[model samples]
Target chain A: MIIQTEALRREFLVGTRLRRRRVTAVEDVTLTVARGEAVGFLGPNGAGKSTTIKMLTGVLVPTSGRARVCGLDPVRERRELARRIGVVFGQRSQLWWDLPLVESFDLHGAIHRVPAARYRERLDECVELLDMGGFLRTPVRQLSLGQRMRGEVTAALLHSPELLVLDEPTIGLDLTSKERLRSFLSEVNARGDVTLLLTTHDLPDVERLCRRVVVIDQGRVLVDDELAVLRQQFAGHRTLVVELMEPAPPLLGLTGVVDVTVEAQGLRQRLEFAPGATTAAELIAAVARHVELRDVSVFEPSIEDLVRTIYLR
Target chain B: MLAPYPQLMVAGYRRYASYRQATLAGLATNVVFGLLRAAVLAAVVTQRGTVAGYDLPASITYVWLGQGLITVVMLWGDQELARRVRTGDVVIDLGRPWDLQAAMLATDLGRAGHAVALRLLPPAAFGALLFPFRWPERPTTWVLFAASVGLAVVVSFGIRFLLNASAFWLLDVRGVIAVWGVVGGVLSGLVLPLAWFPAWAQAVLRWTPFPALFQSPIDVFTERGDAVGVLATQLVWAVLLLLAGRTVLARGAGRLVVQGG
Candidate 1:
């Protein structure tokens, strides 16, 4: 495995000086990611997702158990481990705010002690891949948020770290920028030299990028499984909207239908049912027993809804 | 072993130069205060020819040199570390391979280098034109003065590093820093020369490290002090404070780990 954590846990002290309280931010998380794999870490706010990433990157140490990134202990060998991983915190930037983007890249290269020739080649690659050639010379403070995030991504990759960890990378971007970032990340993951661990609240990002996911809540793992299997097990609901040719009596006795609501003076009706309990053909045939249909559309439960159900459970 | 200090230092120097307008405003403020101080010293000298072995020229030199060292040693408003810590941006810094204290020290050294060339020299040169400024009689005093000023930077950085490191525990260090500013100003002799204090008070002040920050450097510049003794005091304080600051930093890092920062 390229990454491994065994019963890793972290707790923080909170509250006033007069009354201290202990809150466990991460607890008993044992996970592993193989080389060249893409995984999504999913959680709601205050769910220990960020804390776990912090530990893996050596920003925060686990209170007990053990964590090793690229086979190196994250705390004791952090300096050596830093050279092997790239990290991006979406809410903050590591680039020099007042300096030109290229200057920030040059400084990072120097900090990592990248050879000049390799640095130039990698810089060129990032600039081309991220489409950053137009504003390479602009100071970071002047760029739009999307532009600055691109610059930050380029900065993290200048040294060719083997593992890339991103926390909320698409949190506040617009649709177009989010799509761009997702595609960019997919391409990077395609290179087969870097492992990617992305933590996000954005479901499309997970559906588009990850085949596996680990979901945690309140410092404990809730679900860890293949995305396809998770969808099959938890994302089983399908919505059916039917437009009838004429007003008819309500269809209330259909098997497998969980919900039914009338609309447009009973000319249109919507029904939600479990996909595995009954097929769409059976539902249409059962509905035909009462009223003739003009149009019918089936909507599968989106990844967002599936995750929300898991969280609420 | 990446040893990113050279690049960090150079980058810090560039950042210092980039704030041209602020630098100019800072220089103007120091010069204005320098003139005000020189006028007061001149009045004191007219009433009493010498106070604490300081003649009119030596007093004026002390005032100007004190003003010059203000920025050179970063006498006030070093809240970058505290701000980073409060905002949790410091995690990015900690994630880097280099030691945080050493890297910050290198960066501050670069800023001091720029201050000497731009902020400190211009005010001293202008002060010389307006007032009777004293020159060292012994050529070696210049070398010793330079050494003392360099040590002053280390001492000042060490103190500020501790002040900012308080953020790890306090979470908000503005109050601590504000208190340090008011007390450090008088104790380090930025407001008035330490020689102006009474003999009994100077005896007590000698026990603290504040004099090594500004008073000793200015005294060496005016050639009214023993060079070896002043420089030794600064060297000792510099070492002590640096070790203490490093201890604070290590403890703070451990706290951050415990607190899940």
Candidate 2:
């Protein structure tokens, strides 16, 4: 395995003088990711995703248990392991704020001891792939958020590390910027040379890039499954809305329908049902039998909805 | 192999040198302080003719040299490491392959180099024209003074590194820095020469690392003490502080709390 952990755990001492408590940020997080696989680590706030990443990256030593990245102990052989991995924390920039974007790239190359020729070749690839040529000479602090993020990614990859760990890489990006970055990541992953570990709240990022996801909450892994399976199992709820020509009758007590509600003085009604238990045709016919439907719409559970369902459960 | 050391230094030099306005403001302040200090010392020397072997010209030289070395020694508000620790940027720093203490030392060297050119030399040159500056008579004094100043940077880096590492445990480090500034200023001879102190106080300060930071270097520049002995003391303190700083850093890393997400 390129990444492996066994019974990994971390605890923090929190609170004030009179009362202090030991809070376990991550507990028994035994996980493994093979080379060249992109996995999404999903969680709600305070779910310990960042804590795990910190241990793997050697930023925080694990309070207990073991973690090995690229076959090196993260704490004991941190510097050696650093040469084999690249990390980008989305909330912070690794670039020199006062220097041009290219200068940061060159410095990263030097820090990692990349050969001069390889440095140039890899840098050229990153500049082209990220479309950063226009602002290569601009200082990092002056770039737009999207522009700076692209620069950050390029800097991380200049050393051609085997694994790339990104935590919320698209957190504050606009829609167009998000699309651009998503495409760039897709292109990078297509090479199948770098293992990708991404932790994010953006559902679309998981849908497009990750085939498998590990969901955690309250410092424990709740689900670890393929994205398709997750959608099938937890994303079973569907919504149906209807506008009637006149006052509507109750559409409740229908087979497979979980809940129903009337609105606008009976002019409209909303029905919720399990997609797996009832076909849209069967539900629509049941509603038609009860009310004169002027218009109708059906909504499938989105990735966001699925995640919310899982969290609520 | 000195991997990535030069790269970090170059980055630091570029970073500090890019702030043109701050450099100009700092130089102005140093020059002003140099003038006020020279006038005060000149008055004292005129009254006593000599105090602790410092005559009018020698006292004026010492004051200007202290102003010039103010930025070189970097005795205050080096909160960059503390800020980084508080903001979680230290995680990014630790994830790098380079040794943290060595990288920090290299960066300080770069900042000191820029300070020598823009902050130190200009004030001293201007003070020479305005005051009775006593130029060093021997070339060996100049060489030894340079050595002493370099060692002083190393010693200062060690102290700053230890202070900055306290951020691992203490979230708010401003108070620590304030206390360090006051104590370091008085004890390092930045406020005044150790020679001006009582005999016992001078002897005690000489044995501590603080005097090696400001007093020993200034003494070498003024030829007040034996050059070889002073320079040797500085070298010893530099090595000792280097070891002490490294030990603190390693211990701090074990308990590091990168404060923010």
Candidate 3:
């Protein structure tokens, strides 16, 4: 694995001095991400996603247990781990605010100690891949959020790090920018050299960019598996809605179908079936037999539902 | 395992120069203070003619030079480590490839250098127009002034770095920074020369690190070379403060919960 944590925990001090309180921000999280794997980190508000990312990227030291990024302990060998990882915090920017985008890139390249030749090549690739050439000379404060985010993405990649850790990467982007970033992430993952650990509330991002996912809540891992497997496990079953020309008869005990619930509209009934046992066509046929059916449609529960379940648990 | 130091310093220095507004504002504020100090000295000299070590001319000269060098010495306040830690920006900083304490010190030094150079000249010229005082009679004092100023900067940064690191443990950082600002201002002689203080008080103030930061170097312009020993004492204090700052940072980071990460 490129990144691994064993029962990692972080505790915070809060409230007044006279009334001090300790809060557990992260607790007993054990996870592993293999090299070259693109994994999604999914959770709701206050689910400890950001805290886990901070520990993995070597920003926050764990209060208990241990973590290793690229086989180096982040707390003991931070500089070494820094060379191997690229991080982007969605809420904040790393750019020199008054300087041009290009200047900030040069500054970061220097900080990472990328040799001049390699720096130039990597920066050029970033400019090309992220479509940042148009705004290279503009000050960061002058760019729109989308343009600045592209610059941020390019800056983080200037050193060609082995792993990229993104916290809420698509949080506030518009639909178009979000789609573009998602496509870019997918392409990067497909290239097969860089691994990614993307934390986001956008379920489509997980569906589009990552083949595997790690879901956590209150500092604990709820699910970590291939996207397909997770979908099978907690995604529940697909629902089939049939529109009947007349009142639908009760199909209380069907062979393939699991449940038959009456739609609140009174004109249609909905049927649910497990995967593989009944195809959409078979479900449609099964439902049509109980009614003077006009039409039928099948709907699979989304990954959003699966993640919501994990987070709520 | 450390990268080249000079290259890093140069990069940091250029970065500070890139902030146009802050530099311009610093120069403006320094010149205004220079005018105020020069006016007071001019009024005093018009009445009594000469006082202790400074005549009317010498006092005005002192005010102008000290005003201009405020940025050079960063006498206004220390805003580095404390601000970062309080805002949670330190979360990003602590993870960087460079040592947090060293990197912050280097960057602040860069900012101070720019502020000093930009702010120093105009105030001195303006002060000369307002009052008469002798410039360094010999070129060697100029060389000595440069060395004194470098050490002064080191001592200032070292002390401020320690004070700023206090925020890592304290809840109300502003109150601490405010107290440090008031003490550093008075003791560094930003309000007036330490030479003007009473015998017993001057004796006590001279022993502390404050005089080396501002008073000793300001003395160079007037050829008061007798206090080179005092600047040496400040250099010693600088080393001690540097060690103390590092220890504080190490402990603070280990205990940091890094709430927002």
Candidate 4:
């Protein structure tokens, strides 16, 4: 396994009372990722996602459990783990703020003991892939937010580590920057065996990059499955919005339609149905036979809906 | 293998460059303190023709040297090791296939180098222009001065490393580091010359590493001690302090416990 955690737990001592109140930030988080697997960690705030990533990446020592990255213990063999993995914490930066991107790369290369030749090759590849053609000389502090994030990703990959742990790499990005980064990640993933473990709140990121997602809430894993399977489990049916030609009569009780919410126009209504219980034909027939139909459209539950279901669950 | 000391050194320098403004501020603070000390020493020397082996010129040099070296040696706010330990950055550091202490020492060396060039040299030169000269008469004294200054950096860095590791136990470390600074100030000869101290005071301060700091540098500048004596004393303190710091580092690492993020 590229990454593995066994009954991982982390407790914190908080407040000023000098009381040892054990608050478990992560509890029994047993997980595994194979080489070349890109697993998305989905969780709400305070759900211990960052905590788990910290322990797994050797940023934090497990309080009462064990974690291993590439078969090295984070606590006992931290340096070795550091060599094999690269990490990016979205909130805090690890770059040299006042230096140009190239200088930061030099420091990273030294830290990882990368050979001069390899450093050049990696630098070239990163610059091309990240489209950092014009900004290599710009100091990190002066770069735009998107530009800086790209530089950060390049720095994290300087050593060509086997695993990459990104905690919300796409946070606070505009639509254009987000799409650019997403494509860059996809290309990088396709070209290497680097196992990626991402923790994020962006559902589109999951949809674009990760096929498997592990949902966490209250410091526990609520669901871990393929994104498709998750949608299948929670999103049993889709809402069918059919516009009526004119003002239609209200149907109080209808089969297959779990709910019928009315629009202000009084001519159109939203119809929700269970996946297997209702067919599009039946709903349309019911609507058409009862009222004049101006237009018809069928909508599947969006990835947003499935994620919301996961969070609600 | 020393593992390409230049690379490590460059990395350290660039890291300080990242905190350039803060480093400059720290250097400025050192220079200000140096000016105050120079004024104080000048005032004292007016009363006595010479205190210790140093005349008024030598005393002024000592003040400037102390200020310049503070930036180079990082005696102030060097709780970095402790912060890394407390914040879990040390975990990543320890997980690397490198010596923990060596990595930190390398970074500090880089930062110290920057401080010396940018902070120390300017004040020292400015002080030299403003004050009279009290330089070493012999080449041997010059050699000893260099050795003593280098050893002083090592000793001071070792102590700061050990004290900084206390963040493993204490949440608020500024108070503890502040106390350490005060104690070091009293002993390190940054405040007063060891030679001018009463015989009893010299006897006490001589036994500690404080003389190795300001006194040894001043002694070399004023050609007070022989080459052999200066080298021996500085080396002794460097070795002893390094051993103590390493022992403390090992113990502190064992007690490293990281909280949840």
| Model 2 docking category | medium
Docking class of 1: acceptable
User: What would the per-residue lDDT of candidate 3 be over residues A136-229, giving only the tens digit for each residue?
Assistant: 9888889989888887777777788889888888878999988888887778778888899999888898899899998887778888899998
| Order of candidate numbers by lDDT, starting with the best | 1, 2, 3, 4
The fraction of reference A/B contacts recovered in model 3 reads: 0.47
Model 2, range B118-170, lDDT digits (tens) per residue? 88788888878887888888988889988899999999998888888888788
Better of 2 and 3 by DockQ: 2
- Every candidate's DockQ is 0.41, 0.49, 0.40, 0.38
Model 3 stretches astray by more than 4 angstroms:
A239-272, A281-299, B1-26, B227-231
Residues A1-313 of candidate 1 have per-residue lDDT tens digits of: 9999999999987888899999999988999999998999999898999999988988787889898899998887877888888888899888988788888898888888889889999999888878999999898889998988888788888889999998888878898888888898899989888899999989899988898999999888899999988887888588888999998766687999998889988998989898888988899988987888999999878998889888988
lDDT of 1 by residue, B1-261 (tens): 224787777777877898899999999999999889889988998799988788988888888888999999998999998888888988888877777888899889888988998988999999888788798889999899999999999999999999999998888998999899898989988887888888898899998889988998898888876889999999999999999998998888877842323
Q: Ignoring the other chain, what TM-score does chain B have in each prediction?
A: 0.95, 0.96, 0.90, 0.89
For model 3, how big is the iRMS in angstroms?
Answer: 3.8
Per-residue CA lDDT of model 4 for A1-313, tens digit only, reads 8877878888776665776576788877888888988889988888999888877766566778777789988767777878888887676566766678777777778778888888899889888978898999888889888988888788788888899888898989898998998898877887766878888888788888887899888778899898878776898577888887776655557778888877857677888888778788888898787788888889888877887887876
TM-score of chain A of 1: 0.88
User: What TM-scores result for chain A when each predicted structure is judged separately against the true chain A?
Assistant: 0.88, 0.84, 0.87, 0.86
Rate residue A232 of model 4 by lDDT: 69
Ranking by TM-score: 2, 1, 3, 4
Total clashes in model 3, counting residue pairs 3 or more apart in sequence or in different chains: 0
Candidate 3 residue-wise lDDT, B105-132, digit = tens? 7767666666666777777887777567
User: Candidate 4: deviation at residue A238, Å?
Assistant: 1.6
